[model samples]
Target: MTPTPIAEPLFRPEDAVPMSTDEADVLAWPVAAEQLATLAKYWLATGRASGRPHVMPVMGVWLGSTLTVSSRPGTVKGRNLLRDGRCVVTATTELGDLVLEGDAGRVTDVARQREAAAAFVAKYDWRFGLRDGRAYDDSLPGSPEYAFFEIVPVKGFGYGPDGLTATRWRF
Candidate 1:
């Protein structure tokens, strides 16, 4: 699937910083996307019904415009996503920190599952076996089942190095 085009993001430098005015210092969208696509680890944050927050490191694949993550339905992150789709996925890159705020919905299509599985294997060298639109770690014992959640970010933030520039994109 093709990524959806977006308007230019709002660039705001914190505390009236002078660096943000330079167009050369502006963080581009492709650079942020590349960092996310190649990132090995990401943090998934979810909120419980009681307003408690849960954060965990998760394996994910950045494909097209969406980020796909897997978790067992019994897990906190999984149950949270199932109950409420709002969540944040974050990662730290060499350039800066990236935050993707969006609603994550469970993916039940087998074809998309296969595509995500292939991307995971290609990126992480981890193979996923699919069954009934879900995936299991192919190399693990007991073959723990995992449900996939895809987040098409409604907004994203990129913090440039050393508190220089803060870029926010609305999609």
Candidate 2:
């Protein structure tokens, strides 16, 4: 994706941290979709209706420019998403820190959930089955079922390692 350059300066010279101008200018948005698909984990941030923020480690796949994640209905992350669909998912890689902000909605379509289940199995080595249109970790008996979610990014910022430049992508 060719990012629309970040309008606001990502950092200032006087800021406690410092970086050179060339390093800042070189921080461009990644154009390769394969790079995004290679991510293993992302920090998924969710909020309650009251605006309380909660973040946690989550394993998911970048499928078709969207991140697909699953959590048990009883978990805090699942409850927060159910309460409020908006969220931000951030991940760190050798390239930089990528933050994707969007709305997270439950995946209710059986066909889509099946794809997600297979992705989970392929990525995490967990065989999840779909029942009632949600994925369940079938490896354990009496295991709680997972509620799958899809977050198609509305906006994202890739904070370069130099900390002076940020590449912004808008969808």
Candidate 3:
């Protein structure tokens, strides 16, 4: 049987730009280092609507080009992504902040999912016992309930006390 196409947000190739190291420095300069650190925290919020866009903190990792995060089998965020296929993730340090808005999608490729999981473990090994024999692949393959998302940041913003500065990066 043919696999059904998963719903996803619309993304244009022209929108996939790369942010340079120089640009990162420039954008992250104005904010205080401590503030920037705090902003680098997990789970901010993403959605449209005037008041309070359901800020949910989530574990994330900066893989240079894109930020990857995993959610449990069932959750509001997972359900939201499955329905909308779009999200925004934000991280900030006392010195600066970064916001990524883009078309979010699940990583269906087994190898790619494993790689993303490994990267997440490496980034958060100190906080979570990721290598304590708990393998991510232990679960059955193609489990409809299992959810993992790879956020391809299309538009990004870096801001600080100085002013509104921004940078764009490829997912």
Candidate 4:
């Protein structure tokens, strides 16, 4: 898949805020991507059909322009994503906070699943084996199968630690 092109970061600092107007103060796209790739835990928020919201800490990997996460289809988060693909994924980094607003869909491609699994092992040292086009964690008891979901972010926001620079990135 061709990676999505990210637009130049739009620095939109709050008025009267003590942030530097210099472009240097703005969070760079590469910095955000690096943070997303290295962050250990990310929070995923999904909405139920009835309008209830569910948020959970998930282990995921940022691959190219997509964030890949996994869960059992029977789980609440899984069910919610399967039922309603729209969701938000947020992460906190040492330099800034990141929010990803996108839609997630089930990932059934075996090659992509393998790629995601490799990223998991590289970043988190968690091993996942492929079985019938899905990923299963062999370390856990029963070697539970997981359904992978790929989130293609439509928009993203990055806020600097200093109360100064906020950046909006379009996909």
Model number with the top TM-score: 1
Q: Which of the two, 3 or 4, has more TM-score?
A: 4
Error of 4 at 94 (Å): 1.7
Rank ordering of all candidates by TM-score, starting from the highest: 1, 4, 2, 3
lDDT of 3 at 140: 45
lDDT, model 1, position 51? 91
Q: In candidate 4, how many Å is residue 74 off?
A: 1.1
Worst lDDT run of 10 residues, candidate 4, spans: 7-16
lDDT of each: 0.84, 0.75, 0.51, 0.84
- Write model 3 residue lDDT over 42-143, tens digit each, in one string: 664555333335568877654434456677535767666656656887765554555667676766766666676666556555222223322243344543
- Worst 10-residue lDDT window for candidate 1 reads 4-13
lDDT of 4 by residue, 1-171 (tens): 655445444543555246455665556677788878887899999998889999999999888878999888889999999999999999999878888899999988889888988888898888888988878888899999888899999888887786566777787
Over the stretch 39-126, how does candidate 2's per-residue lDDT look in tens digits? 7778899986677899999989866767888889779999999888899988887777777788988989888888888887788887
Of the candidates numbered 2 and 3, which has the greater lDDT value?
Answer: 2
After superposing candidate 2, which stretches have Cα over 4 Å from the reference?
A: 1-33
Assess the local accuracy of residue 98 in candidate 2 as a C-alpha lDDT between 0 and 100.
77
Give the Å shift of residue 48 in candidate 3: 9.2
Write one digit per residue (lDDT tens) for candidate 1, span 1-171.
Answer: 655435343454454445465556556777888888888899999999899999999989987889999888999899999999999998999989988899999988898998888888898888888876668986888999888899989888888877867677677
